[model samples]
Target: MLPDQSYHIYNHANGSENIFREEENYRFFLHQYEKYLSAVVDTYAFCLMPNHFHLLVGVKEEAELARTFPKFETLEKLVSKQFSNFFSSYTQSFNKVYTRKGSLFIKNFKRKPILTECQWQDTFLYIHLNPIKHGFVKDLRNWKWSSFHGYESAKNPSKLERSYYLNYFDSWQHANYLMNIKKEAIMKEEME
Candidate 1:
């Protein structure tokens, strides 16, 4: 069931290292991302990878969210249209730069609902760790591309819902919780 009630989405990259390699490409993607984020719903966490991105979004209304996407008037179409906007925006920029043509992403963006308290916590930790997982930095604190530092320590530098995030965990404990996520445990749990 899609947008069964509004959900948190997990969207992956096309192949690998495709989206956030160059400064210009990253900027373009971020601009569209910010635009789309502004258009609908609230985001709890987001991680932009070289090839893909992940988001933890709270849906305001499943129907309204679907309506905002021009290509989709229904929840099912929302998935394709949403990614279409992202990849199409990026590809248009990329094509002009490289004089290339064709799709940038593999296909539609992936989606999943954060249906449980454990899922909410785990998904938050997972997205925050993306930079570290990919070896972009030695610590979650080092990645400037993510919302982790914004939520945990600094001001809402990314224009995200920081006040809402602040309700999720104690300020002091936020860092500890993210740092101490056991990879094996999370993999097992999320898989199941």
Candidate 2:
């Protein structure tokens, strides 16, 4: 995680245990993330599942980060530290609630750089469509946990970067159409 770079980061549980056991579990995980990384990263979209979660985020600009953390020499290390803290915060709370101990998520979150418009669009769709892909829901719009819901309900108050879609598609409605029309191919590719 470097400054001003967009990445698709995701992680699953260590075993069969779920990372989110209840609705509050999901909200708490998100709250922890916001508390730790809101200033360090620009959140684009996210999806929290039963045993894993995905996030499409971009590191804050280099100049902004440098100003924010004047004591840190390398912004990458600072960004990584924030993420570590976030994971640790969630793990501690989750462990206590479950009445069990040990790692909740697999070590070292998997991340892929979003280098092009195509990759960014793919990642955005991928993250939003995770519930459907995982069989958690048949309709993406009904999944209240995902940022995809933000697109449909303009009144949805969230920290997500909802306007990112406007950069790729003509409007929010068009963005919705693109995502829906491409659903079949996207789901097919995910299966492969």
Candidate 3:
């Protein structure tokens, strides 16, 4: 959650239940995420699945955050609070709509800080490949819930920092390499 750092953040549902019950659920969750976290983090890539989600984000620089929040000394607290609010808002609405109760997600989410180029790339491809590994789709092209669609956009004109991450490779074809990966081996290279 620290500023100026990249993290592979992920969390699963409370148990066997699914976090995203419908297509609108995924869209609503992303809208909430962008509303609360955009100011504090630069989103790179993300994958929203049925029961869980993965996000690759880099915390904004201190100066950037300072402009968003006057009280800069408590930058960490503000950033953390934004995430807490985002989660709570989504859960509240979900419960109201589904007529359910209790926490929707597990108690604590997992965030692995990215300190190296290799880890960042690994995390990016790992996230983009999640749907395929989980049996949602045989091809990444067929999955509509992931940020991969953003990358495939005509100008990459989405909230996702697609161009920045793609810059790591030689060209867009390099990103196509994700499709070349075997399904069984992808989940094995866990982010941690």
Candidate 4:
């Protein structure tokens, strides 16, 4: 969660429940995410599964955060608080709509630092392919809730930092090819 650092942020629904029950739920969650997180973090990629979601984000520089939230004591605290608010806001609305109570997500979300080039590439692809990996979809592109479509369509300029990641590959096709190769390698290892 440090400034200018890349992290893989993820969380799952509590118990056997699904975080998103319908298509509107997914859209609402994303809308909330953008409203709360867009200023503190630059989203690189994301995927919203039935029970979980993953986000690859780079924490914005302290200076940028200062500009966004001028009264904050620390940039880290500001960013973390915003994320907490994001979750709470979504959960509260979801609970009211479903007439359910208690926590919707685990105590705290998990975040892993992306320290190496390999980990960064792998995490990006991993987020995009999660629906397919979980058997929710056979093709990555068929999954409507993932940033893969954003990257492929190059339409969502406001959300994903697509150009930054695309620079690592020769083309979008090349990126997909490498992602499939990585997926195959992972599946092979899982089988062994």
Candidate 5:
């Protein structure tokens, strides 16, 4: 895996995509994501498709976000504590509701570092515009499942510093570079 390659993850519904078709499943996923955000992660952006989801998170180097246990004094311990607790809780809830599941996620979470400003911008665009590219909505801002509207419309409060998105270009018009990402990427298996 390259440092800046996007980390894509998925979990099947007992070897099928059927589970994702329900609104309840999406709601569960959102709840779990919020827990992760409130605890282990700083969410810059996200786009939730039907069967899978995408997130761009900045990991804190130290200081755990929440804890039901005694204090953790190391970054490694903090990371492990949050991920394990979050995943376990989600899996239990999912299995109880769905009545089947060996695992709710594929593996230990995968990560890819964003090395340059260009890659960072592209990744953000890719995540934000995903719903649009899939024909889910006519405009990126109309999609309820993504952070594009939040970053672009100021409708959602995200954990990322607003300055990072603003600093990408001289003006939002100049940074409205989202239109340039190839639609062909919609056919790519990892992201689309």
Candidate 6:
């Protein structure tokens, strides 16, 4: 998670467990994520499914982080620590509420850098369409736990870095057009 780099971060629940059992659970998880990650990264997109979650984020520039945490020796270390704390805090609260114990998430979550325009577009559609791919919904917009709604609505300017990514498409209309094309292609593949 280097500064100014876009990474696709993902993690799954341990075994066959559901990370979120109710709507409130999703809200709580997002709250914790914002509490820990907002200052360190600019959230581009996200999707929270029953057993897993995905986040497209750009790590804040070194200068931005330095201004926020003047004493931090390295931005990478600080960002990593924040992520660790985010998971631990969420897991602890979840355990206490559910009357269960042990790790809720798979050890050492995975992340891949978004190094190209194609990867960026693919990752965005991949995350938004996860519910459909998993048979949880028939349409991407039907899922309430993803940032798809934010992108489509063009609201919540503060939460998602929508403008930054939409710029890649030149306009919201173009972005939606591409999303539909991708969705159709995926659905066509599935039907084959």
| Candidate lDDT values, in order | 0.65, 0.86, 0.86, 0.88, 0.59, 0.89
Q: Which pairs clash in model 4?
A: none
Error at 43, model 5, angstroms: 1.0
Better of 5 and 6 by lDDT: 6
Q: List the candidates' TM-scores in order.
A: 0.74, 0.92, 0.91, 0.93, 0.71, 0.95
Taking the tens digit of each residue's C-alpha lDDT, what string does model 4 give over 149-170?
8877886565787777864567
Give the alpha carbon lDDT tens digit for every residue of 1-192 in model 2: 778889999999998989998999989988999999998998888999999899999899999998889999688999989999999999998888778899889999998988998888889888888888777876887787888877777686878777766776788777677778777766677678
lDDT by residue (40-102, candidate 3, tens digit) is: 999988999999999999899888898889875688888888988999999999999999999
| lDDT value, residue 80 of candidate 2 | 89
lDDT of 2: 0.86
Alpha carbon lDDT at 40, candidate 2: 95
Q: Give the total clashing residue pairs for model 2.
A: 0
Judging by lDDT, tell me the better candidate of 3 and 6.
6
Q: Report how far off residue 90 is in candidate 1 (Å).
A: 1.8
lDDT of 5 by residue, 52-130 (tens): 5667665543424324333656545665566667667777887788787677665565555666778766776677767
For lDDT, candidate 4 versus 6, the one ahead is 6
**Candidate 1 lDDT, tens digit per residue, 1-192?**
244333456555555536566777766776887665555556777887777777777655676765666565566556445556666777788878877667666665666776676676767777887776666865667777677766666543656666555545665377456556654454455558
Off by over 4 Å in 3: 154-156, 182-192
Worst 10 residues of 1 by lDDT: 1-10
Write one digit per residue (lDDT tens) for candidate 6, span 1-192: 799999999999999999999999999999999999999999988999999999999999989999999998888899999999999999999999999999999989899999999899889878887887787887777899999889778755659887778646778777778777877877788899
Q: Worst 10-residue stretch by lDDT in candidate 3? A: 183-192
- What is the lDDT for 189 in model 3? 54
Tell how far residue 62 is off in model 3, in angstroms: 0.3
Ten-residue segment with the worst summed lDDT in candidate 6?
166-175
How many Å off is the CA of 35 in candidate 2?
Answer: 0.1
